[model samples]
Target: MTPLTGGVASDIASLKVGDARYCVKFALPKLKVAADWRAPRHRNAAEYAWLEVAARVVPESAVRLYGRSDSAHGFVMEFVTGAETYLWKTALLEGQPAKGEARAVGDMVGRIHAASAKPNFDRSFFWNRDDFRALRIEPYLSFTAEQHRHLAPQLHDLADMLYDSTQVLVHGDVSPKNILIRHGRPIILDAECATMGDASFDPSFCLNHLILKAVHLPAQRTALYDEVAQFWRAYAPHVSWEDASDLEARICRLLPALMLARVDGKSPVEYLGTPRREQVRKLALPLIGNPPATLSDFVQTLTSRLKELDAWQR
Candidate 1:
């Protein structure tokens, strides 16, 4: 078995049985971060169920589940590796941003949300919010609120709003690191935080990564910005369960908080240097205080600040 390295909340390894290769994942009670972060191991079951749901909605976009082990608190899935598949995060970090793949990801996520939000859809199995709160709300928003008392009210409000929302099934961790591209289609992994919650979290979670990647790789910012636009444009049309405008408003409000979370929350992005971290703070704080009402407005505000920072550095 070869252990996979990027995940924090679980132990992931590539295992081969005879000629078949499979991926095995076991939930960790305590996340592999420096912080004293922990969550229930039952999230492994939730992730397995989430993959099943995604496969039903968008078969091509979800990893094929092989089997699950209740006692072991882990599951086996198709080990997807070939010349055709590559980690999206690694590609973006290496400056290989693909607009097509971004659009595909948006489409896949949107389809899953739309399908799950239907009146006849059965999502009771994912009704529990404990895992989502333990993994996402507390660490990403509530914890950050504790660190920045001045932003506590707004951060806490966002946390409450997200925790209380029950409109659709959320993947909960849609960052680039959990995505793999195979022949231009996105294969989503890591749904340990999946739950019936705010749909805004998925897109906001994803865009946060793209925005941070741009911040880290300034030379690739323009391309990444286009990728961001493609993703939102593709995803927005599927917001049929609620007012698309209202959802976008929530996303705009939530985006900056997520941005701040990456730098100050329990799971800070590892690639950013100290200067870039400060830049994230500068960009995220004001926006969190007075969030934009639209995604375009948020992007505009972000781009303007990025340009100003670039000029100041010169």
Candidate 2:
């Protein structure tokens, strides 16, 4: 096996699984998209499920999972070689409008989420909360004593309100990196966090990454916001401003918590790890008090406020 790429969570390798060698992505337990906050997915099972669903719904994008044999902690997947979807999306974020690809990704995710349940694919594998730990509480609950003062009271109230507010089958970690834009379209990877319920979770996960990426490159914050809106527009066109208003409101409140949890929790991104981690927690701490009114309001306010934050940082 040849080393392709490596990170804190998972390491990508290329190996032969018979005559055709597929890309083997050995994912660590921490990177497996945990059950409680992130919700976990058995990679082998996810690969099999998505493969079956993709065969019917969005056939072009799904990969075939040979099987999984657990090693010390992490497991791997066999896949065909492809260009980096993260690089492709980053190019788009840099102004290359892969509009057709974006729409295709939207259509794919929508179809998969909306796909009819088939016999081979059991939705229960993903939806069950065996290790269901609220990831939202991580940043707040695990805060250092100094950080605790700034967060404790606010987190308490937020947790109280959000404890049982809503839950759903979420692709808890969808981002540019998890996607593969082969040529002009996106094929999704890593299905461990697919859960059932609030549709908001998946889209919110996508949106948060765009915002987080924008934070580092301050000048392109607005562009990132546009990209986020475009993706969301693709995912949920059926729900208009009136229909999805409540979901959006809830999503906005949940997002800061999500972002904070992501950074301060276990799999924090080293790129924005330490400093912005604290910044995100502090930023999200406020939403525990006043959530937005609708998705449109949430997206509008969320993106707009994020721009202001970038401007302030500059």
Candidate 3:
């Protein structure tokens, strides 16, 4: 078995049993570095549950879950191989341009939420607010607010909105690292943060990564911006909720807060320098203070800010 290093919440390894390779995972009771964080061990079960649900709703984008370990607290799934399969994060860092893959991400997320918006999906097993607070809210939002005391009210308000909303099923960690692309199709991986929550969290989380990536690889800013636009365009039509406009307004507010959190939070993006982080904050702070009327307006404003920074310059 070879250990994989991309994830932080779980123990993951690639194993070959006979001719088949499998990705095995074990959720830890506590995050390895921050033992005091109090992450739940049962997240393994939560992820497995999400895999089961997603496989039914969006099979093309979901990995097939094999089964749980006979004796251990873990599960097994197909280990996707070959050069065709690429981590979206690695592709961005290496300057590989996207070709409508972001749209696929948006489409799949919409499909899952559209199919699972019922009042009886048994979220009781994974109604894990404290777990989410410890791993995500505290370290990402609240801790960042502590670092910038002035932003506490904004951050806390956003956090309250997230915890209060329970409109649809959400795949919490929808960043590039969790998306795998093969032959132009996106396969989502890692659902430890999966639960019943605000549907906006999924796309907003993803857009945050794209914004950060634009800052990291300034030369690819235009391409990344187009990708973000593509995601929202493909995603919006599938939102069957009556209050789509309100949800989008919420996403616009949440998106910039998440962007700021990534820079000032516990797990700041590793590649962002002081200048890049400040550039993100320049856009993020204003949005958090007074958000745009729509997602399109947010994109337009973000694009303008990126251009002001001359992000396309070499």
> Which candidate leads in TM-score?
1
Worst 10 residues of 3 by lDDT: 29-38
**If scored against the real structure, what TM-score would every candidate get?**
0.98, 0.72, 0.93
lDDT of 1 by residue, 1-314 (tens): 99989899999999988988999999999999999999999899889998999888887777888899999999999998899999899999999747487899999999999998999988877875878999999999999999999999999999999889888999998988899898788989999999999999999999999999989998998888888889989998998998888888888899999999999999999999998999999999999989989877887898999989978878
Off by over 4 Å in 3: 33-36, 69-71, 310-314
In terms of TM-score, how similar is model 3 to the real structure?
0.93
Per-residue lDDT tens digits for candidate 2, residues 193-244, read 3444355556666667766666655566667666666765676664432345
Runs in model 2 lying further than 4 Å from the true structure? 7-11, 17-19, 26-44, 68-78, 82-102, 116-121, 132-169, 238-243, 273-282, 299-314
For each candidate, the alpha-carbon lDDT, in order, equals: 0.91, 0.54, 0.82
Off by more than 4 A, model 1: 97-99
